[model samples]
Target: MVGVPTAIAILAFEPPHGATALLALLLLAAAAAGFREPTPLWYIERGWAVLLAGGFAVSTALAPTRPILDRSLLTVAIAGATVAAMGAVRPELLVGLDWQVADQFERTLARYDFGWLGGPPAEAAVRQFAALWQALYPAMLVLASVSALAVTVYLLGRVRGEESALPPLGRFRFSEHLVWVLAAGLVLVALPVGAWADRAGGNIVTVMGGLYVLRGTAVLVWLGASVISSGWIIAAWTLAALVLYPVTMGATLVVGVSDTWLDLRSRLGVAGNKE
Candidate 1:
């Protein structure tokens, strides 16, 4: 349900199991039309999409408009709706996942930080970092939500076999345009435009750093197949990665940054985008 994301806010962090169960029934109906009833995927998607959108709106409309949830919820609702539509033809993709994701984001806004872990001796620095973390939490939520969706899409697809709602996984590649993201974040951190700008910049680094790591992993996978297909070698690399984490991460970051020009994957003739 597209609007079911707002229902997440209305339900206060835990998605209603009732709506989820109902959604499952509707999804089954849609799937049936596709596999058995000679139904157009678009027709089923259009019908249920409208129904889901209404439910989502009703839930959001009912949420208590306190402090920031009023505004942030709307923005997230829009984002969740967009994500939902991206897989409209797949019933499982409409699995009210955005609700769970919204709940996690809600909790992050409420209380997510390294406070329990503690850091630095300077009181002022600690408070400043806390404030910064709060500002960046939204961006974190976006990345986390997207990641969860990807994982869910994959896992659920596995369960459904050929009937998997989402499409198959393709080759991985980070965008060259994201290279500017790294530069912008560095500049923002180096020179504070404003508190908001600084927060955004730092969060950009966080998100983009994650992408870089993914790119690095992609490189490793490609190399595993091309350089040496030995399972033992791959296992050794994994062990090394676990043991030398910071070094591995730093190396990945470097590779990711250099990829803008290197296009290492392309050079290896692996997953080079024709586009």
Candidate 2:
């Protein structure tokens, strides 16, 4: 299910060598995921070596002029593209989700006495909001995949009676070069790209922007952690998120983008180097 769409999406971008790249990426990702949290379980203990070896084999086959790849970024792009491809192939998937959201919205509204707020205008507002939500389904799915990965990592640690090796959210950062991907996305959006390419660019911007928000928040958390207790940090963040969402997000996004250039954590002499 995942591989087919992912391969198709990659081929759309790099037809001649996409399949080989996809195979290499899958091997590398599988190896990294397994090796990061190796278990005494039979399959994991036995299979991770094979996965790593396979990844190396593929890379070697393309050696001398091996295509440069950022394993993490490519993995994420492939996952997001796969999700968007799935929606494209069977749009009813998103339609079903949209219907569920609309149904729940109506049910909630029915339970509330909107009084003057409930009218044709309110109905129109709901319709508009629903349309916006449906359009954002691709970005939502990309974020959902990240959330699911986090949950799975947490749960794996719990099931194994071990602390997760995952770094604290406060220390999160990704490659600074990823800003180029977001920039490329913006250019695509601004230009008269084909409809499909434009939509893909929109998805890229939305997903990357969401990630940078988290990275920016992490920078803030790192700053706060040095001076305040975790409880206070959490409380403050929760309050700000609830009461000043747009302001907080905008500030964080700016901070995140700045961090890429400024390398804020290192400047503060508190680079969390656990990874």
Candidate 3:
């Protein structure tokens, strides 16, 4: 709904080359969703959300062309309501996992002028905006990383619980089969690099590592919940990580060491030799 108009507007404004990348990213996201171990109802909910978000975003982007406004409004309504519903279902996840880290990033950005490295801003307002964004980028990354780490820890804890009541890993098990597919995808994606920075570059490894960690954590949480009544605590930790990762990562960069070491150590101590 929203995305169709948005995509059309974007195509109208941007060159065809941009569409390719956008489409690829969307496809990747779709593939990732396919791998999730969700019930039919869950899938329907997720699908609708994705569609609404995509549609709204695309339509908004292309709004200048004077396309149908009612449909766009409907898309926005659906997407917004869905997000609200999600929050209602998992308020902790919404607040703990998302908002805390977002605040940290915003604060960090305020500390530094946005890092605009490119050409001169066309206007004073634009320049200020760019500067603001530049300053905020590092903080945002740190926040995102912290959030991710927290989620990972929470999931890991759940996986280790003995009496956990968490759901099964199901399609999101991150099994050998999935690993192989991911590996193959990586190799295929990386094959185009030249000698200066070959296919097996640090960037490739970094991306793959991140993916592995994310998927592994999700699976661990699922498994942990299966064996313990208190497995949901893992999800809480994940939320914490997501919120704190950005600030923590930024601190690590500034301090020249991993900021999460103490936290990780403490968590390990608590978990003990349960593995």
Candidate 4:
């Protein structure tokens, strides 16, 4: 919610290609989440995600031309404050997932060194791309902060057993280990962005802020999926797509199907029972 709105607002002021990319990604996410399993709750939650994503995309498409710094700073502030507050309350929410993703991304970067794939790796290319990314990183951080804050509040409400204030669905009750895995994955992807931004002399706070936004957005998308599908398996697959794209999506689907089969076997007493 925070990210979509903030992105829209920022793009409205100073349109950028990156904003379009973010908006497109969000739209794809909403469409993926909207797949049906024949439930009222599913329709409602998926509808919300789709609506929000569309709103953001349309806003970005029509965004006006303006100075990047001026447009981004305001958006970043709004997003950062929200994410920070969320994190302070629910520190465990995103940090673990962020770490995991950051680790995986680092390993991938190390192995392929795709820098060479794009012609001879040049310092100038890396520097130019890094600079552009650095400039945009702050906005990402701010949006992440908002997402973290929202998740914390949601989790805290769940912990206190305050179901009334939550969404129509109850608090997410997935395994803690799973949450940790997701958090670690998020951190893994963010590490490179953070490093690049820092080396480019981007503000550290802004960099951290963007990292959190990226983390928080991932969490929000996951939560949204969980709400829509009423099953962690679906949500997990959706999140894998959001974070790791095609590769993670494929892996998650395979794992989810296996887990589902095991669950069915256990439920039918076929796995651990004597006939």
* Cα-based lDDT for every prediction: 0.55, 0.61, 0.42, 0.42
Model 1 TM-score is 0.53
Stretches of candidate 4 off by over 4 Å are 1-71, 113-275
Q: How far is each candidate from the true structure, as Cα RMSD in Å?
A: 14.4, 12.3, 20.2, 21.9
For 1-275, candidate 1 gives per-residue lDDT tens digits of 32233223224333456754455455545444445444343453444444433433444356523212222224445655665676686766534443434454456545645455563445456557655555666466656544543443333334335364432222456457767977898788779578767776887788778777767766666667678878898799889999999999988878767766888877777654311
- lDDT by residue for model 4 (1-275), tens: 43344333334433466745576356455545546564443553343333443443343344423222222333344434555576789997446434544454455445645465575466456556645554554345444433533443343344345775333321111222333433444455557766543433334443433333333333334445445666776667567667876565444444333332343233433332110
Per-residue error for 74 in candidate 4, Å, reads: 1.7
**TM-score, each model?**
0.53, 0.61, 0.25, 0.25
TM-score order, best first, reads 2, 1, 4, 3
Write one digit per residue (lDDT tens) for candidate 3, span 1-275: 22233333334444567544485346445534645676443454445445554544455455523322223333455555665688799887545534444465456545744345333443455546655544344233323333332332233234335353222332122222334534554565577766424323433333334434544443344445554566477667657757998753443333211212322322333321111
Quick one: how many clashes does candidate 4 have? Answer: 34
Which ranges in model 2 have alpha carbons more than 4 Å from their true place? Answer: 1-116, 229-237
In terms of lDDT, which candidate is stronger, 1 or 4? Answer: 1
Using lDDT as the measure, the top candidate is: 2
The lDDT, on a scale of 0 to 1, for candidate 1 is: 0.55
Tell me which residue pairs clash in candidate 1.
Answer: 3-56, 4-56
